[model samples]
Target: MVKQTNVKNRKLICDKLLTFQTQLEADYSDKLYEVSRKRYAQIDDLENVHTGFKSAVKREVKSLIPFSDIYKETIKLSFERVDAQYQKVEREYKEIWKEYSDNLSLNWSILAPAVEGMATFCGKVMRVLTSSNEEIDVSKLKSILYLKELNL
Candidate 1:
């Protein structure tokens, strides 16, 4: 009876942990999506700025004499400014993603082994509870399993 109770306790703990893991995964996914959306929006805004500036420069140059020094200087300065802004944004985006990736790796390292252990324990229980030669299908346990994220 004590052994049975211990098994029950362990199963309960696994269920709770699995639920928590699922929630954490969902939150991480949402954060990733948000970050991607913001980054793309910034890129779109920058592209619009670049296109608008080029158009304005073209119009201004049309009013100047061909190959004028002033037109040449204006084009060079505009290109430099736009290139600097793009590089800065790219650096910031990479830094943000790098930090996120580090955290994700750390979390997975801590979490995956525990999850795998629990899954193995559950599989053993299933084996023992069924006939010796019975073929267990983990997918069929979805009704009783808390790990909705796992394909198994």
Candidate 2:
């Protein structure tokens, strides 16, 4: 009886852990999609606005005398802003991935042994159920059997 209760508790914990893990994965995926969409939008805006301006400047500088030092410095500063934005996006993505991996590792470590033990206990229960010559309580056996099937 105590063994049966332990198995039921382990199965419950495993199911809850698995559900939490699935929810975390879904949240992470949604966050990644949002970040990717925003990144693409930023890239598109840069291409539409800055690319045309840069091309016009290059063409004017080529046809005319030359680019002023101020123009060159302004372009460099614009590029620096782009670089900073890229770095910020990369860091945010890295942090998200780290959090996802840490959560996954912790959940898996806790749930793996519990799941394995539950399986072992179920196997033992099955052996006893099938091999015993005496009659058993069918309701109790069915309840325990249902508990064994609660995967995630």
**RMSD for each of the candidates:** 31.2, 32.4
| lDDT for each residue of candidate 1 in 67-139, tens digit (9 for 90 to 100) | 3553455456545554565566567767986896577655577788888799778756654553123222222
Pairs in clash, predicted candidate 1: none
Score candidate 1 by lDDT: 0.47
For model 2, how does the per-residue alpha-carbon lDDT over 17-52 read when each residue is reduced to its tens digit?
344334323433333344355422333333333334
lDDT of 2: 0.44
The parts of candidate 1 lying over 4 Å away from their true place are: 1-67, 105-152
lDDT per model vs. reference? 0.47, 0.44
